[model samples]
Target: MIKENVNYKTLDLHQRDEWLHFVMKCETYDVFYLPQYVQMYEERGEGKAQLFVYERRAEEFVIYPFLKREIRGAAEGEVYYDITTSYGYGGPLYSLSRLKNDDDFVREFRAEFERYCKAEGIVSEFIRFHPYLETEAGLASYVNVTSVGELIYNDVTKTEEEIWSEVAPSKKRRIKKSKRNQVEVIFIDGKDIGPKEILIFYDIYTETMDKKQASSFYYFSLDFFQAYFTALKEYITLAFAMHEGRVISANLLLKSEGAVTIHLSASFKAYLHLCPNCNLRYECILWAKRNGYHIVDHGGGKEKDDSLYKYKQQFSNTQTNFHIGKKIHNQSIYNKLAKQKSKLVQGEQADFFPEYRQVLVTPRILSNK
Candidate 1:
């Protein structure tokens, strides 16, 4: 039980740590969607980008996991997770385990949020919001949930050896034989590398994007990578599969909370026939397991039962399918806009960037662990 009285001051590192620890125990602990990443994004922000925190005064100051966003609608402010680090709909990171005894906590938390929102002249908006609120704490006026879509994770722990052994023979053979193909998979600690490789990654990336009839959400300038390189480097693994001094495949993954997130993966078209893409991912799983990670997420497969669904199903130790849910804060406004916008997005077939529908390319990398 903590209480404080305060106004207007962003969380210093010391305060941020104490605040999160309090929230973590309150039954709404989600590592990925926490405010810390939002803070990270803010520290890295430039130009017009903004980051906001919901704070309350009590025994210990409380902060919520929302970041400041600039958007257009009825409102100028929205709560967001770090779009880059946030894989799926980050929503509000709340622990359902605290529902009953957290009455005082919730009342206090909401009071702080409302007071802050009012003080800052901010309004709530969600292009896609947390589905957990509906399942765990239910919903209210301050919270408006939306369906950005779902993200998937594979559970490998329950998978039996025979299931693994049954993978398509040709695929397995490719994995087995790729070892002789004169390729080097090197893991680099984030430092000691220049931006030369980032462009290489995009080149190999665009090749696959073309094959899939998709486009990119944002083509980052080298400067963008340079900007966050130091802070992000600590938590990320940059893996490249090289051949004859030429880089053929690469994966930009994040290792946090014992979880490895696959952010970007790509390989040259020349190597596709060799199944280097699959081999690269297989090696990732091995690294994940050996490092004591609980799961390696290959992520969502589109078309509900697309070809990828078949491919990743082979390695699934288990499947985590998030449900798509929504809550409209304003029903009339939503009903008016949903139809035309929905049609526009469905036309683009963009799965990764839910905010806009553009053709999306799903790249595959193959290699053995």
Candidate 2:
């Protein structure tokens, strides 16, 4: 399906500002696709970040932010080069001026892109499609896209009471009870958050991860947060829930284009009885409404049906589908890895793509509870 003569290349770090400029003109772009977000991962030494640009004929171009990681496949002493979207949902952002509503252009670009991946011996490619952009349909021609789950978000245009009424009855009661219990929720402009507050947030975040028995990959170091918040200050908001002047829970939000995304949130287990987390989320919705944000995305759960999703459902009745796109370019190596991994997993039914990574997934981190 890909046409010849299409120019596709990976942009180096030097061209980062150009890439950022392109993303700025995109109507569907998100903060996750920003240059600062990519730099954070690169600084962490997570992988080699690449911005793949695909120019269709001489008309339009699309930018795909990718991470190139050398993963040890199932074969002994063998490494496979694979690419994945960033930790957050960041797929491809297209040029609005050149390719607006041009389905043919998107199809041609994807086809050419797949050809390039095959030529480079990419084992596989995985994408966490943007939740707010609604660009899944445009990507269907290139990858196997699936509806993973639904994200919960609030319609900020609704009146405070109207929005509150949509919350599950129990949630409304919890918010009321949290206030009666003297739990105070406040928002700190990102620029005002200092090192001390960042450290405190990291402690709560790490503890929550530990208690949940999460994989090591989910853990972020203090330096990462400091760099991230500092670089993205203009777009971030830090919310804290305090009980008698002690911070009990905190949430990080990224505001962009009239939408606020819940980036990170954690609550001390000891304060769970006080419903501080609920108050924090409720206040976030109100803050988004008051500050002119049109929507507040609470992200999604680990699975389609889970406690985390249910928890988010308490705040809003509106839901948005989250999609994931996965594809394999090197079939022979993929099969080899799958076969080797299948041998190691004797009894359980393994559903992980590339299969070699199935063993790395910690069983204890079963859900986003």
Candidate 3:
């Protein structure tokens, strides 16, 4: 005996808000994913948000709110099935805790949702079943599970002097040397760059992507730039490292809560001699000091211990570990296949990382700092 309310479109927003608010209060709840975000996503003519819920009789349907979008026309901000996708801490926001039909409910919920996804052909990739969410059993049906790290700094408010002091002695020397070489570090926002100034940032970004042998989720998305600046300009910014008038390095940062999310970044190889990456990061940290943000999530890149991690760690000086979980559309099948493959070689899982997989390309992909 199960019941469900899947018609997000039919339900008035207040009802949805009430449901989401309750879910938001759950012990595992993260901040609301910004309701207007989903509206904005639809207004963009990119896709739609749908909800499919199953409630057991006597056991009320306790909705764990998730954002959803069809796979064919999915957009960047539009992820399907998020209990707390954007908030960086949205998994099972609340628990039924002790429902009599717990096991029966899980089965019904999974079956109905799987049928919904198949009928709708929703896009699991965009859903971003963050690596942290994989531990939840029910989520497996709606997402693709994989490993993703927050690439966060341990401390966001360490003093400037502290930032420098924490650097490996080797990196310390490099920064001192870069400043000596006459490299200029600029901290700016989108307004800092005239439209004409954009291409310069693109070239540097392309170079870094090429060197890393990887492509970010967003490469040259002007639309996303417009959305970011228009919707989140207050909390978003960019950092650029320049040598003379030429752009050599850049990093895009999103200011949220009390810290900055280092969304994306790139630099030139020839300029590696100057450590423009390190210098630009330092500038952003200082800017964050006066402006208000205190933390930085550089995001996961390559195998750890490379020059990139070292550069970010120099300023971060701390590590706050979090995983990016993913749930593919079909888990039972995939798990069975994975275990089969592992029997021959002990394979763990498959995912978008190791290749630096990303999905959003903001105009600020270049730096304003």
By TM-score rank, best first, the candidates go: 2, 1, 3
Compared to the true structure, candidate 3 yields what TM-score? 0.59
Off by over 4 Å in 2: 1-6, 56-59, 73-80, 97-101, 343-350, 362-369
Query: Model 2, 211-250: lDDT tens per residue?
Result: 7787778889999999988989888889999999899999
Q: Which candidate gets the maximum lDDT versus the true structure?
A: 2
Q: lDDT tens string, model 1, 1-369?
A: 122563424443446665555555544433444445444545544112222333333333333344454323532354322112233344433434444235665566556655554554343333233333333243343343333324444444434354356456656677666667766677766665557765666577666555565434333344555554454665677778777787788887766554676666777878765556666766776666666776566665655667766676565445544433222233333333334355543211233332321233553452344
lDDT of 3 by residue, 1-369 (tens): 122544212122345574455444433322233343333444444444323344444334434334453332233554332122333333332235443135566655656655655544432423333222232545444444433443546354666687667666766676777788777877667555544445555666666665555544334455544554455544456677778877788887766456566666888788788777666776666777767655555655455566666556655556644444454553333334344334432212444321112244433344435
The Cα error of candidate 1 at residue 287, in Å, is 0.5
TM-score of each: 0.65, 0.89, 0.59
Q: How does candidate 1 score on lDDT?
A: 0.50
Q: State the displacement of the C-alpha of residue 90, model 2, in Å, after optimal TM-score superposition.
A: 1.6
Where is model 2 poorest over a 10-residue stretch in terms of lDDT?
Answer: 345-354
Lowest summed lDDT window (length 10), candidate 3 = 347-356
Question: How high is the lDDT of residue 330 in model 3?
Answer: 38
